[model samples]
Target: MDRRAFLTAKKSKQPASVKPLPLEGRTSTGLAVYTGAWTKSEITHLLKRTMFGARIDDINYFAAKTMGEAVDELLNPVAALPNPPLKDYDGVTGAATPDNDVANGATWINSVNNDGTIQSRRRASFKKWWMGCLLQQDRSIREKMTLFWHNHFATETVDVSNANLLYKHANLLRTKALGNFKQLVRDITLDPAMLVYLNGRSNTATAPDENYARELQELFTLGKENNPNYTEADVKAAAKILTGWRVDTTVNTFPSYFTSSRHDATTKTFSSFYNNTTVTGRTGTTAGDLELDDLLNMIFAKNVEVSRFMAKKLYRFFVHYDIDAAADANVIEPLALILRTNNWDIKPALTTLFKSEHFFDVLNRGAMIKSPIDHAVALCREWEVVFPTAAAEYADTYGMWNYIMSVAANNQQSIGDPPNVAGWPAYYQVPQYYELWVNTDTLPKRNQFSDLMIGNGYTRNGKKIVIDAVAFTKKLSNPGDPNELINELFEILFQIPLSQQVKDQLKKDFLLTGQDSDYYWTNAWNIYIASPVTANYNVVNTRLRGLFKYCMNLAEYQLA
Candidate 1:
């Protein structure tokens, strides 16, 4: 059934089932440091934006720290980068070559294989591995920032068509998730997957491909909306400067090399927007690298435009989508200044914005519809949904991750493959913005996904991975008290606070089983606690499952 029909039926029973964001735009709270209370509400808000989901343990762990300390810990990730994608599949049938070179569970990232079927399987492996990273992310903002950078510097694995190149590109994003933005742009310019995706490899002295150059200015930096922005001539000049770069597959490292012969040696000039700056082209090996640096310098010199554009994108990703005049003046403008003042080091700016009063403001919470990946990851992480271990259950582990990737792809936020070079429309599209995530088709699928995860979950290789609702409630302060259990669950699972009336109704409908007294649930839970025998266990487990499933299916759960 469609989302409209489903939500309508749901709302008929529970009036608070479908709460949409207010038509009025977002909070006017600026980048001033917030001195407000740092309760579960604020902690949940911070974690939801920074991490996949705010697990109970994560919220409580961060609760010990002051706001600055928590933000500091989040920005500074200490974990080692995850190991590369492995060869998870058996031989691909009806193929030109076999993938038997790499062992069943060994990493295929460094191995060189040009076989189409093998590359295809490796691509699947790459996506599954990426999902695993998101699932197993540490208590830091690294994963979320990595994803933000991925969307910002989008390169499609499908278009690149090389699994090794895709893995390298992904590694670049992860390695520099919070590194210098200007350096990242430079790195991405020479990245092999980017060269393949944006036709940078084909850009030569005789013929220039304006694809990457145009995107470099329009989408990446000096955003298209800015008045007197980089001209078409500037794009052509940048493309000329970027010529001669080609992926060097002959070398073991598979890096992109500068081909001196293919480079344009003529001087390239920019428009008035860049103060008529000219990048003097040079000859020999250093020409491509030097000219490219000059081009970036010229663009980044427009620091206001570049920083503000970046701030807006970051704001949309971490905060609300809409950027009103007040938000632009109070938040985006100053945030841009912070970015520029920090010399494009992303961590400080992120640190400030995340700790600001505006971030903690009530209106800022529950302002965005969670992206498909966000929703899926949050569901698994928050619920502590179990997956098979990669060490022993290699196939099953990857199989489960692959299932999640497929579900996300179907929901329109495919990790390795966004719809286009512009990335997902939901991030940058106007009027609708994040609202694009929910629609007739995708919303029901979202609900169905949570329902499945909360219920039977997805079974892989004879192992069923689902939420252990009984065990999860056992972690609560008082599972015996129906009201406290509901309150605790709401605090963890929801961004917006539910009314006491709604909580009372939920208790009656699910835990209390329509009984007037709360002991109906309290006694059932205590009985199960005393004797976890099949009969008593079934009584509590059934109620808890129903409670969680119904809660997850609510419209509030859809918001991050």
Candidate 2:
């Protein structure tokens, strides 16, 4: 359509927030497949929950496929594991431990460096690389799931001070992100960083440290709130079964090892919650693996509790925070059943939940408050903010990543280090689950981040990364018409739709220069499109920048 006819044609009213259908009403359809209209709203909801942020390209791409196909592709990742973090910190400080073995640009994950200062720098580099992964993530759910598992098995880089060990622990989480949950627990039990953080190395026959054992059931699997859960005696017995495992710090490869001398060769018995199961004592070389298998068998036997606990966590992360009795009975229970029926495989359960009618319900949409990382990364992607390419400008790219990581850390969701073993309280804490992410201090900082990006942005190594307002607006379907432009921007930037009155005020105040007629914006956009000169570009660009800035500051932008 030509610009004049497009503006003169009879246009449909702007879509309001999703409302209940006349027939189905607000009642949830539960885990059944969603057969509703697949528009931009539905696509945005799916990607917002599954990935970090929903890009326009991704939205258009997924719109052509069935919801089942999109969810399947997200669950099944084919991308290779990202290369390890490099040695990108040399000139920052002279007093830090000199990494003599690795070159300046080489990856430090393989070389074992025990120096405290150098290890600290490497940890920072790891954080930068992690931020890059989120920014450059594929269409799959690997990076998000990797972060979920990291929080599930929380560890602090400060506590586990070895950089190499931290890399290995994270690699383990990424590798088994969508794999078997039961086996992930098994692998994390023997991870060297975990052994250091939870005092697993100190757990021996003479002095049994119950730190890891208690957390294994209480936090990781069965959960502390379950009725008739494992007892204190169960914790002690589990610790005894796990006594012989120790970290071999000298070797860089496979640092965790089992020591026969440290093994407590006594029969360990559990409480009636475990059906009074007993792991028999063993001797010789394979005692540690044998007892561990027995322990996992005992814990996973109560598949109902294990599955329910994990199902709740996943629900909170990927769906809404408040899981009332209705959600529990209808959504969580069936999802847990799917998880257990699949023998603890994570893919099938997530696939069913993402494609469910309950998940795509109107009430479920825009219910979640974006976490710190979500707020930061989504702004970059949805605005098409640019960052230096890592392959071409390694230091400049990592420096930009470090700046991004620092912003998120200041807002209180550090990537490599969560606050505690229970992970971020926002995921599991009751009464105010995700609301913990936004307080007086963090909210201002959040707005400041958006303000900075849409305005000046951050600069590093002679490269300035900022959101180009004109570039973003040009990508819209109809930028010449002020109403259509607002509609397209609202469709991408917001989870919920703005009222028509508010959108009109926004257009008049910013786009139309406080005038009543639409031709003001239409003529200005046309002039810029025709001439392609600096003064003409400034006219449209200035208005677009103001419009975006005002929209981002709204409370609605913070919701997913």
Candidate 3:
């Protein structure tokens, strides 16, 4: 009984009774309050929550919108930018050109030859393009989703240094970012980077590596602890079934093919839990490829396991982590049903989750803390601050853009690479993710970055870019009514209502600034805009420094 026969039989079998909930009702935990309008504070909170931080343009854009409109836009963003064409890695014409000899001097001089130089150039180009996407791309959701999948797939550069291999993997993720989950999984299993990362490069009949096979079941498909659907026997059997896949480095491209000679031509068997199948005599010239496909079919054939596992992970990533058995039966089960019904179409499943009433529940709001990448990207977007241009002229220049990447790297939040195959540990724990993202060290760094942004120490090139406090204040139509202004600001900053005490405190702080209402509001805006004042700058530098110190010290800075 091979994997295919096993899976086909499993699908036909009926599952146990499990009562599912309505797609719109609250979880077992109960419902959250429905705040009427989104304010500046709310926009700020939203920016902090959904993205890295607020950019000036993003803040203004949300500030002008109503609550329903803002939520709608976030759920179904129209501004997503298309992925740019990837440069070839073969050093053929139109491939990403090598940096100057001077740039490659140290690494190349120490290495054996041109191979090292080419690899170095490819690495540099890859990093630049990835970072560029963060700074300049208009599509926020695609980038966000890319990051999500990157963690989920968890491939590393150590296995495949060929730029083409990495780029191909990345392109696949971009293309299928919001597509079908089944296809995405199938596509990833064949990716060259993934093949190399998981030791599938040498998976063959003589010696099979269980690395990829085990992880596919335990990590990617069905999680370990919550759902122990597959056993050790299943893993060993799957490994034998998966042998024979290999990379064609001659092309220096991705989507590696199968080498028939290397495939294991033996039958495999699983435990009684897996329907007690004796998968045998299935091997042929196309054994490896067919066996792998058969294995996936068998896995998906167990609809209950995939459904429960995916729902839990998706809930942790997109909603709350805490799971009640009743809620799982209701929300998770129903969403899983959609996936099963639609052959695992990811977009529809996600769309269903977003539109579901439970998504907007107050309890789900502010449940997740901003990951480091989210925090950084949101700041750039909300402030509308222009990052470094990627032209040939200033390729060596270093400042905030460099600093931003450095900070991210330091915080163990590199965009392209995660800590391991498992992904960021904090995201797995649920509500504790809020506490997990920050600690004594990271909290201060977060504040320091905020202060740098609000103070005059920060700059683009050599020129001082003013945040235009007056312009921000003038955007408000009702300067006379402090409460209205605060409410309006909150609408721009966060998508949730501010408590009366928080509003009053902000109002009192604005009044103490000694400027007129409009002036004071504008000044505060300026402080947030022109942060990180360096010594020996301009006149506004001192004021910006003082204001930044005060603002970063505030507890509100940590919330978003």
Candidate 4:
């Protein structure tokens, strides 16, 4: 039967014609293939890849829907952005003069208003708040895409020291997360936080800085070697065009503005790289806007390089990090075609990819090593972890932000403060792209954090009851059945394949207490469900915790 009809009739008797996609070494061709009956395994794979973690109820819902419905639910986000509601710090109302020694007034202003201790506190709070957003995911892809864009156009809050502006920059990213890429680049260019961070505020016609301009081309758009594409001359011209932008973090409204006089009004010429193009100079209030549009038009018009660069980045993000020859031929090329055909609207292309057969290839499943965020957030969701409030987490001891930030930060993926401008080395670095996420330094920290949560539960601010494995099991569809509990937990927690002996060994050790019969586990769990007392709870809870922690601590749990 077809996938849709089978989903509607019954899932238990579902028959599927799913063959693993022709992939090896974690890469496959990009062609679409017909789908068959969807199983729980398929649902498990879908949710883990798309959402942070899968809830059993959510999995059942998607399993009932058709392919279009499932893809649309994810593609079209319908949730509101988190309301951090940060104060807009005013630095311009009564500013310090350039007292001869104060030539760089922006840096001076930041130093005066932003105390080091306060700045560090605000950054920590922001990281925790963002972690909650990642954990809850009230809206799905926005947070995911915000992170994607953060890494894509990385800027550290330490460099952009104004918390309000950092908050403002984050809002811009989250709002425009799934919107137009061309527009996102335009907005990012003028964002006050970015302006101050990348020294775009200091960029001028007299002394143009190529920091933002070079990254705009190299990191955001054209990658390295696109023929007839870009050059050093192009970067210089772009810098001149982007000059005269300023940030007034002092004001609540209109923090970022253009200084018309500071803008370069000289005609900028391009090499044969861009058909020997020339952008006409203007001397008015609209000069910056006009030049920006002209520049974006020049870049976006070369759809091939721009499209491929974005497709490759997104694929590496959601799928495997390393792209093999088969992936290049099948995946990247065709995905880029979809982007070009859609006027750079991201939804259609992403929808096409996520719902395609290539996405569900058996070889492709769990091929990616989990980033710190993936590892921390997924486990917390499974364990039903709860932490203190972050609406305005105090910077004192045992703050929720403190715990969350330190957890991810210690694991080598600091939330708000990525290592540098080029983002965490894992995303951009070669050969050992994802391998960089784990090292001697990070693995022990990861293990320690996992042990803390699984063993003691995150009890802070008078909050406890972290991972009640006994209660977790009782809520399952077939908790009294030992084999059922083992399979179900494995399905929920582990991503990689396991052998029958491995499954039997788990059953023998954790649930059955070395007995060959499943009755030991069944009687223990059934007694707990019936009595609901401390002794019964402990009897089942202890075994469940041991098993749950063991599964999570396994290497397979390190993948999505």
Candidate 5:
């Protein structure tokens, strides 16, 4: 559409009707009260929760809007775009070549090489595009959903040197991330990277590898704890069913000319858990493709397994990890109902969760720690920062981000590659996962990041990255009273109302600084950016520095 027509069309769209807030008497005692229609705190909370985090500019833009309006914009973002496809490699067909020796640590490169040019370029491009997507992608839902699926169908490059195939698999996940859970599962099973990683390539008639098949049941389809319906026999049978699927290492294709010569045409049987009729067709000889489809059909026909499996995982991811009996009946069961009814349509399940009253409950807010990816992405979104242009510069920024991921990984929360195929141990209800996230090692790192960002202590090289605090102050139309400004900042940062003690501390700290409230606030932030003692040369000694130290040391800084 032309710009003029687009503007006219947008203007023509009617505003959604606003719902009145429930009365204090009708609402729960713990529910927060809003003094005005909308405030900066609410906007900040929405941004932080919906995106990664919010910047001062982000808070200012939506501060005056109602919660409903702000959330609507987030859930249905305008900027998010579809993931683009990777450029295909030339002269490299799907055939098993010697794995890159450097990648395998079999040979070391003293310097960059002229040979292996295509492979090197592909790897670089893949990293650049992957980071770009996280930093610059317009589609928020797609990006977020891609991250979710990346974890769901977790595969690493440790085993696969074919960068093109890896990129293809990653793109596939992004493209179908939010589309259909069933289709995604089917595609991943056949994905070349997955095929290689899970021994799908080695799954043959003589001896079928049970790795992928076992995970398909125990980890992917059913909850390891509650649903143990399938047995060892079932896994072996499923493995046999999957044999003859192999990657064409040359072109990165799959189900390569299933050698009927090498095929295990033997019929396989499973317990009552699986429909016996589905596998009966494979008696003497069956096409590999038909057998695979029958297996998927059989799995899908047992809707109970998929629904229960998906609903539980979704609950742990979006909601709290703990699932009560009542929640199972009310939230989880309903989610499963929608999933099955919609034929495993993911968006519907997500929409149901987002629209539910339970989603907006006070207890659920600030419940999750900002995962490393969450923290990095939130910072970029809030500040509207772009990735650095230079590769070395990009690497430095990525190093900082990766350092955080490493800390989380040490705490058992890596984003790209989790601990195992089962994914970050935390997703499961492991006590150690929670305990690991806040040990002595990780707490200091988390505090350091908070001090650097919120406290304003970040730097590049020897120089401090200055925040434009004066510009921020001038942007506020109504400067209002000190109390109002503090309230606004609190709302934006915390989302929930601040306790009286915390509020009083902020006021007292503001008074002690003695500069104009705005300037002091700004400089206090500058102090935060300089708190890392090893990076201390980037910041000078100042009162704001001292205050930055004080605020970051507080317990509240630990929350999302």
Candidate 6:
């Protein structure tokens, strides 16, 4: 626990290279593995993509089940992991009463800018809550999809400053992350946080603002890349169709409201791009909901691009960024058809893709680089690091949130604070795509974080949280076997193809200490297991930490 223990720990003597395994079905678990023949590596790959990182017990449990069963378990999120409540109460008064005017909007602007206030502290707590969820949330892959949707329907806390609204907005995404796509669009369109973020709050029939409408088609539904399906006319029509909705910033909750007075009572028509669709606007209290439904029906039912666009975006997010000619025909195009046929439900496409033969392609294992959240969370999960937890029971969770957010920001993927409406460039952007996550600027910071977590451990407010290397390595099915530890840790830590020679060298140099005898490691491990207070456990722990730190610094470790 002492910092001196870290500085005195043994260090890796030499760096080793572990090449990525090619896309070939050599071993039973290698590339071309069918649904039934699930390999350890294949299971690891599934967890890495779905669970952010795989827990040892999860890997062992799912590895025994058929691929179908595994996929089914992932699709059905566990009901046990409830959303952490916003238990945030700032001693400040709620905003003034709503007058069907922009008073609430002005009040929000002031609160979003304050630094030394409970509002700001509450927002930070809100983000920390989600990050803690990432650490401890059930491994049903729901959180992964929630994160995907977060980026897809991106909103930052800086703009939507209210923690209650932010909490509502996020829970909306989690509840229906795998649900129907149209419902999410409608819900987000009227969400108070979203309305404010995209200037939907300012939109009125008299002077319609096209901010939300443009993004609805451009960024959310039909992507702007090479698509000409929606025009500026459609955005204006949508804006007119979406008017009269206002956020009542009065009272404790600034809920959205429909104002019939400001509503555009006339019929709004779309251009030929949308198949000449028409949303006949109404003036009643339900006008906003009715017209918004009409607009979604027009986009989803009338035009087919929405399904394909959403499918493609999800494919890129979950799988490889580069969909070549072959993959376009084989993967993306077919996946789009699945999306359309399934009525835009996310589960079908995800089920088909994760279980498909192409997903298990060995070369695809380390194809995408891990985002900052993914990288940090993976290390924590794999190392079995006991977090101070969301409650900060034993550690400074507030400080942990700031630390994680700072690392993500430095790495260009700030969690609750995306740069703009487009979310993190790692999810989108060209050529580089995920490669942008690690460049000259972010790579060192990521490496430094791993070093700190493993070396000195992370400390906040004088409380230390370190990965118990001895405890973790002992969790292995066979800790005494040097060769087993080497290979197994590779499966747990990195997804790349680890060479046998490299594995042997790692065992010899680190675990075996150049001894050819397997009993050397076995005996040392036995002594540690019997009396861990002895020098034997200390040696084992030091070697394991040194090797882990070395692996974390390797280039292969950067990729999922």
TM-score of every candidate: 0.95, 0.94, 0.77, 0.88, 0.74, 0.87
Residue pairs with colliding backbones in model 1 are: none
Please identify model 4 stretches exceeding 4 Å from their true place: 1-28, 85-117, 227-229, 388-398
Poorly placed runs, candidate 2 (over 4 Å): 1-27, 91-97, 390-392
Task: Report residue 380 deviation for candidate 1 (angstroms).
Answer: 0.6
Q: Local distance difference test, per candidate?
A: 0.86, 0.86, 0.60, 0.73, 0.57, 0.75
| Candidate 4 lDDT, 1-560, residue by residue in tens | 01222222221211234322355534333546426457666777777777777666676688788866876887678876775623212323333431232221112222224445555545655666677677777525677788888998888978887766777788899898878888899999999888988899999989999999888888888887676568899999999999888987555443789898899999999778677888988878999999989988888877888999998899888877777777766678788988888888787778877877667766566667778887777667666665544434322223543565667787988877788877888887887888788878877777777877768866665665266676567657798888888787777776566667998998999888788999998999888889989999888888887788777778777777
Per-residue error for 50 in candidate 4, Å, reads: 2.2
- At residue 352, give the lDDT of candidate 1: 85
Looking at model 6, report the run of 10 residues with the lowest lDDT sum.
24-33
For residues 1-560, could you state the per-residue lDDT of candidate 2 as single tens digits? 01222122222222233222223222334676777878888898989888888888898899999888989998998989888888888724653556777887888887766677788888889889998889888898998999899999999999998878888999999889999999999999999999999999999999999999999999999998788889999999999999988887566684899998998989999999999998999988899999999999999999999999999999889888777666776678889999999999999899888987778876677778888888888888888888977565888888988888888899989988899999999998888888899889999999899889888889986798899999988887889999999998898888776889999999999999899999999999999999989999999988999999999999888888
After aligning candidate 6 to the native by TM-score, how far in Å is the CA of 162 from where it should be?
A: 1.3
Q: Which candidate leads in TM-score? A: 1
RMSD (Å) of each candidate, 1 decimal: 6.0, 6.1, 9.6, 6.9, 10.0, 8.9
Q: Compose the digit string of candidate 1's lDDT tens values, residues 40-64.
A: 8889999999999999889889889
Candidate 1: misplaced stretches above 4 Å? 1-25
Using alpha carbons, what is the TM-score of model 5? Answer: 0.74
Models ranked on TM-score: 1, 2, 4, 6, 3, 5
- lDDT string for model 6 (96-212, tens) is 322122131122322332233555656776776777777776869888988998998999997887765787788888889889887788889999889889988889888999999
Task: Mark the regions of model 6 whose C-alpha exceeds 4 Å error after superposition.
Answer: 1-33, 85-116, 389-395
lDDT of 5 by residue, 41-128 (tens): 4355445555556666656566656655555555555654534323323323442442343332111212122235445545544544
